[model samples]
Target: MVRLGNLVNAEGRAARAAIVDYGYRTGLLSGLAPEPRERQGAWLTPRRLAILKLIAQGQPDRKIATAVGCAPKAVTTAVHHILRNLRAEDRAHAVALDHQQGLLTQPLVPLPEHRPRRVFSALEAQLVEALAAGQTKLQIRTSQGLSAKTVSRLLTGAAAAAGVRPRRGYAALVDSAYRGRLLTARAVDRASAPCLPERQHQVLIGIAHGWSDEQIAHRLGLSTATVKTAARLLYGTLDVATRAQAVARGWDLRLLGAPRPATRATARPGAPSRAAA
Candidate 1:
C-alpha cells in the first residue's frame, strides 16, 4: 500500500508539472514557474527601490552609485539582481517592467545640479538625430555631406559617449541617451517619427518580446531567410547592431505598441506559442 501511495504521488507531481509547462508555453502563465508569492515590489528593499528609480531616470552606474551613496560596483551588482528578479532582458526592459508593475511611484530624490558634459560634435549630433528620425544612411550622407566611413566613426563615438557599447550602434546610443533625458526636443521629435511598415513593425515587436528569429518566421509564415533579411534591414534602418539593442530602441521610440496577445498552439513543452510572439 505504501509503495502504491508513493507511485500515485509521483504521478500527481508529474501531472502538475505538465500542466504548468503547458500554461507557460501557451502564455497562460505570465512568469516563470514558482511565481513570487508576494507582490512584485515586495522583494525590492528600500535601497534597491531607490536604485531602480535612478535607473528609470537613465542614470549610469557611476551616477547611480553617487546618488545611492554606494560603490559603483555595488550599484552594478544591485542592478543585476534587479534584472534577474524582474526577469527583464536588459536595463530598458527593467525600466518598462517596473513601470508596468507600478513600482515607479516612489518619489525620486533629485541629484545635485551638475554641469552636463558636451559629448558630440554638431555634425555627429545631427547624424544621430537623423538616424533616430528613421532617415536612411544615404539620406543623411547626402544631406550632411558625410562619407559612410565618417558617419560610422561618428556613430561609434556617439554610442560611447552615451555610455553604450560602441558595437550596439547608433540607434541604441540614441535610445539610451533619450531615455536618460539627454537629447534635445528636436532629436526626440525626429526619433519619434514612424519608420517601419506594418509587417516589419510586427517583426520588430516580436524581436522586442524576446522571440527567436526562427520562431518569428514560423509564426509570421515567412521563410527563415526572409525573416533574417528583414531583421537585418530593420536593424540597419534603426541604426542598431544587436537584437537586444534593437528591442530597446523600438521600445524607447514607441515603435512597438502594446504587446500582442498570447496564442494557443501545439508548441514544444517549453517553446513559446505564436500568440506570445
Candidate 2:
C-alpha cells in the first residue's frame, strides 16, 4: 500500500510538471496568474502621490496641505480619494499599503525650508526609550524622578509627534524593539497575549466584516458611544493603533472567519470565452 501511494504521488508530480511546461510554452499562465492590485501605482496623480509621501512621513493633514499648496479641506478630499484608490481603510493603512507597493522609494517633494522639525525633550526622550524597553509608566516614573502627570504629558507629546495614539506608544516601542532584534521570543509572547472579553470578541468580528461603529451599535442594540468606547478598549487590548491593524490581527489569530473568495464574472451566452488550459 505504501509503494502504491508513492507511485500515485509521483504520477501527480509528473502531471503538474507537464502542465507547467505546457503553460510556459503557450504563454497562457502569465495571463491567468494573479497579481497584487497595488502594482498599479500609475493610478495616482503626482499631487496625490506627494500627499501619500507626506503621510508616510507622519505629517498631519494641515502640514500636508501646506506642503501641497492646498487648503486643509482639499487635503482631506485628496486623502479620501487616495484611500479609495488604494482600497485602504484609513491613512495609516494607506501608508502601510504604499510601503508594501514600494511607492515611497523616492522623495515625492522637498519639505518647505521654514517647516520646523518636531523635537523631544531630554526627559521625553528617556520616557520614550523606557516605554520601548517594555517598562511600565510607574517604573519609569520611579527611575526617572518624575510624577505620573509628567510622564503622561511627555508620552502624550511624543505619541502625537510620532502620529500614534498615546496608549499605543508602548506597543509601537515594542514593535520597534522586535524589529531591531532587541526583544526575546518570550518577551514578544508576553506582550502579544492580551486578554479579551467575549463582547470585545464580537466587536472584533464586526470590525472584520468592515462594520462602522454606528452599524455595529445598531446590530448589537447598543449605543454608538458604547460601540466606540468598546472599539477603543479593543484597540488597547490588541496593542494596535488602527482599525485595519486590529482586523488584520484578529484574522491572524483566527478570531474572525476567513474572508470570502472573489468569484469570476460569468460571460454572456453569445460572447466568446477563452479556452480552459
Candidate 3:
C-alpha cells in the first residue's frame, strides 16, 4: 500500500500537479475531480466553461468578476446562469461535468514517500533568526522597503514548508510573536515604508485568519498571484520566518483581534475557583 506521506512527497516533486494533489489529499483544497455534469442536448458557452474552471480553483464571486473583468454582481449572475444552463445542483457539479468532458483538466493526488517534514528558504531561516531576536513587520518593511503583505506571505509559506501547519489556537501565539518582532524591527528606521494597498491589507488579514491565497484572492477581488505577492510582502515586512508568526504578530498587535474577554466571570469568591493568572 502506498503511504500517504509518500504520496505527498511525490506530489511535491512536481509544482503544478503537486499543489492540487497534495492540497486536496490534505483537505487544504476541494473539488479536484468532481463527477461529470451529465448535461446533454445543450452546449456551454466558452465563457461559462471558463467560469466553471475558476470555481474549481475555489474562486468566489468577486474573484470570478476580477478574472473576467466584470462586476462582482455580474459574476454572481453569470454563475447562476451557468448553473441553470447546466441543470446541475451547484458549482461543484458543474465543474465535475466540465472535468469529465475534458473541458477542464483534473490534477491527480500525489502519494507521499516518507514522513513529511518542514522546508525552509535561506531568507526564511534568516527571518527566523531575526524573529528569535525580536523583529517587527513595520521595522523590517521600513529597512527592507518591502510591503507588509509580502512579509506575511513569506512567514506563512515558511511555516507551511516547515511542516508546522497551524490548526486551532495557534493564532494567538503567532499574533503575539509577530507583534513582538514588529516592535523590535521598528527601532531601526521609521521613515522608509512600503506602500500597501487596502486590498492587500485585507488579504494579509485573511491569511492570518488561515485563508489560502486562492480564497483570499477570491474574497478580495484579486488574483491568486496578487494574493501570493501580498503574502510575500507581508513576510518581508515582518522579517518573520513563517505565516504562523506573521498571523501571531497580527493578533498580538490587534491587527487581528482576539476574542473579547468573557464579559462575566462566574467563580465563587476565594473558593480557589479559578487559578490565578
Q: Please, what is the whole-model Cα lDDT of each candidate in the order they appear?
A: 0.55, 0.53, 0.49
How well is each residue in 139-219 modelled by candidate 2, as lDDT tens digits?
889999988898888777654433344543244332222222222122125345665654466566565444567766765
Model 1: pairs clashing at backbone N, Cα or C within 3 Å = 263-275
Model 3: per-residue Cα lDDT over 1-277, one tens digit each:
1354354443221223333434544566555555545554434543455565666555666666665445778667877887777676766555545545655652111111111123234555454444434455666667667688876776665455333454332332233233323212222232444433334446556655556778667655567986777677776766555665665444434444333332232322332222111
Error of 3 at 265 (Å): 11
Q: How many clashes in each candidate?
A: 1, 0, 49
Q: What is the TM-score of each candidate against the true structure?
A: 0.33, 0.28, 0.30
* TM-score of decoy 3: 0.30
Rank ordering of all candidates by lDDT, starting from the highest:
1, 2, 3
Candidate 1 vs. true structure, TM-score: 0.33
**Stretches of candidate 2 exceeding 4 Å from the true structure:** 1-28, 32-117, 172-277
Q: List, residue by residue over 193-265, the lDDT tens digit for candidate 1.
A: 5566334555665564345678667655557886787788778767776664565567555664322222121
Candidate with best TM-score: 1
